[model samples]
Target: MTQTLPLPVTPLTAAQQTSLVNLVRRAAKTEILPRFRNLSAHQIDTKSGPQDLVTEADIAAEAMIARGILQLFPNATVIGEEAAAKDPSLRQKAAEAELAFIIDPVDGTWNFAHGLPLFGVILAATRYGRPVFGLLYDPMVDDWIIADDQSPTRIAGAGRAERPTSVSKPGALETLSGIMHYYLMPKDAQAKLAPVLPSFSRMGSMRCSCHEYRTLAQGGVDFNLSGILNPWDHAAGVLLCQQAGGVAKMLDGRDYNIAIEEGYILCAADQGTWDTLKTLLSPLYE
Candidate 1:
């Protein structure tokens, strides 16, 4: 028999946690907020697809956030969406790092670049590819939803007392509502999942996982499904959903890891909801 040792994981000190919150807020104010609705057409660019986008705000904010992270935790790995996009290898490196900070400087760039107020910043800390902590911050709202795996605790913002979060109670499928990224799926997967869309009462995407997860944590929505699997997009939200008394996993039954390259993720408020959704959506992924 072969023996394997568990990965060494360290909890973030109170100081580090507080520093991270401040750093993200400062980056958003200085680099992201200033550039909102002010970017030139040339300042925005596309990758992978026309619907996928990046902007000067994303670039600048990522630089700021990454730099700040390095300064605060010199030994930690920092991976930004822009840099990872440029060099695909960063993703795997982050997945293996003992401590890593994965950042989505400006989530929903398509929305951010188009003068929509739906985008936000996401920061996720992973230890050996598993999320240890997650933060979803909305620059527009000047608030955030933060969680960590140890206690599975979720907090809203500064000075706000930590409160237990619960997802919407399990309900009839026809009465449930959630965010679904239907257009992001492949054509064939879309074909298979289209018929099932109406099984739920309503399905829409805010185009931003930050807001989407925030809404789900607060029970504003019952669930969300994503055909695309980007660690920076889902890692934080996965922890938040889990800590908020919800269920999150790949539709194919695999747990989410930073290195996962392909798989659809379905997150819901509870196990019953998760099982129902997985049963309904499993065929599309398979």
Candidate 2:
């Protein structure tokens, strides 16, 4: 087995922070936008299956982001969703690297490929396996929801002032609204959770973690449950959620890590909600 090195505890500089956000925007404008609703049949391909997709936009945007990162931080390890799909070993290296970047170029590839406007780009900087900086960029709106170790979660761009944001206050279970990716759960787990759906005020999956995290951080939603916990998918969102005064933990109640992939994750608006939701979902894991 390869040894995993501890992540450096250094924080990102002001210029590095700015460059990370710019990288996402550049990729979206130069690679993603032109391919939206304009993909040739040959430019798209299925990865795991029909529901799991990869397109010219995803590939091109990831390449663009990867290049930008290497240019700015030449020694940093860049692990992109598409590239990881092709080479699974890269994920392990990313998890162990002192300075690493995880990129989900097109987070909602299904929605994007189908011409839906719910897709977005995600970038996370980690030391070892812990997230230190996160950026969630929406191309259509040209805005970024960002967070770092030194700052609370905030939104910027589109000529608007950067404003701090937080998670919704905990409400009664009957009045709580959240997203759950039930379909991604195991059959037995899904069966166990089926009856728990109507307990929430609103329960639905947006098929996009980017939007779900945005909603949670902006106080638009109370909680989110993800059956699949890939680093590229959850790393940035989890950090942003935590920075915005929320709680994110694995089913076993461990802190979210970039190397984790098996356990489910529950990110809630507050600790009270997290405790309640964990108890509610305990049956599935039990």
Candidate 3:
């Protein structure tokens, strides 16, 4: 397989750019916000099991996004989380497409359905499997953390400036704070990593990758680890982290690719912290 290089990206025009942000806000206002804590039993369905869920809000928001993307960029492929769940091949198609918009309409479905404000919407624009732009939108706060090839990561909202953001500084492993969502890992891998949790000053999972990435990009956390490597979940986050002067790679130390799923991924504040994290987690996969 050939490696995909991060080439210079064509920046979206001011209108085109704002359209993406508006898409997220529109979905949140029309589809997501109305259903938060308001979903009925009929509105929820299990994908793999009880812990793996899909809600009406997810479907509605994804549909809205998909429609909007096709309308705005007719040539661009739109691969949404819910749609890809129904047809796994769409995931592969998106990775291979020349221009694609990958959407995670409701990233933290469980939290949203349960009235938790931890959920968010994620959008990633990829050119031939390499992310060129990423957006993580928090509806509760109506803020967006955005990153593109042309600029550093930044936060934008109604009353706030588009302030540049970066990752937290690297710290000793024992003093580092980060997120590790262990439940998504294989049983044996979980067992292997269980004893290593105490090595970090703080080790927890927010059950929300969107927020996890937000925490990392805004200098709120040192690193983030995950065993599940879904494109919708990590593509935008990883790009945002990288643009924020952080390092993100597979546990095996390869750069992240949307085509690969099912591996450990570590995104950290800096190269040193990334190396330390990979060293600590290598044993689990070894």
Candidate 4:
């Protein structure tokens, strides 16, 4: 019962913020938890290839989140994976929205369908197309990783933590070590990265960038590297990272803008890791 006030309520009342988070969490519990691992073969769909997957769980999860969010904020725009894929206009709206919910109903849809417990819900609020608040909830773990502008919160059932999470400094690019999640990058890139660091490990594509980002923010992981990822994938995660005293940016050292559909994302625990990664990655882009 360590009760404290939620921080950085900018454009939202504390009540609204709590309500929004509860709504997303409820949606996940109602629409996603029951369906996890209950999928038939037909419930799965191919997006790019066998590796890039979607399932009925993903669509159902998105719908539940969208409906719940829209019910509370009627004027609030919503950008979801299934909906955004069907209508390119949603992407445009996301880039221009003042207040909106970016939803990834079942971030690790593949894991969910396969009876793995790695997936979770990713929901974030954005103003003028910039992320402001984020929540990543894992139902199975009964944990919620939340990010407001002022602080990061990790709540599991009755327990919660409000603290800043950061990374170690950059030493040598050749000896750098961190966690990487390659969505669709070739394995060769993973192998080549070994020489760039003492450890460059891969955390399989769980489809939930929010969870990965939360892990980084909490110091559970060092970094997350991804190629061919969209804003919906990292919007909430990046915001959480910032709140947790970490940094999430493009490899080019630019702020990650939600205006774009897809780009490479690099998450580091602190400025030190960021500087090291930037120096090492610079030549590769050339």
The best candidate in terms of lDDT: 2
lDDT of 3 at 118: 95
lDDT of 1 by residue, 190-212 (tens): 88988898898888888888889
lDDT of each: 0.87, 0.90, 0.89, 0.71
Write candidate 3's Cα lDDT for 171-224 as tens digits.
788999989888888888888988889888987888888999999999998999
Worst 10 residues of 3 by lDDT: 5-14
lDDT of 4 by residue, 106-178 (tens): 8876677778888878888887667888888787876677766665554444366544455444454444445
Instruction: Kindly report which residue stretches of model 3 are placed more than 4 angstroms away from their true locations once superposed.
Output: 1-11
Put down candidate 2 lDDT per residue, 40-146, tens digits, no spaces. Answer: 88988999888999998998899989999999999999999999999999999999998899999999999999999999999999988888898999999999999
Cand. 3 Cα-lDDT:
0.89
Runs in model 1 lying further than 4 Å from the true structure: 1-10, 158-162
| CA displacement after TM-score superposition, residue 243 of candidate 1 (Å) | 0.4
Off by over 4 Å in 2: 1-10
Instruction: Please give the lDDT score at residue 132 for candidate 2.
Output: 89
What clash pairs does model 4 have?
107-207, 167-269
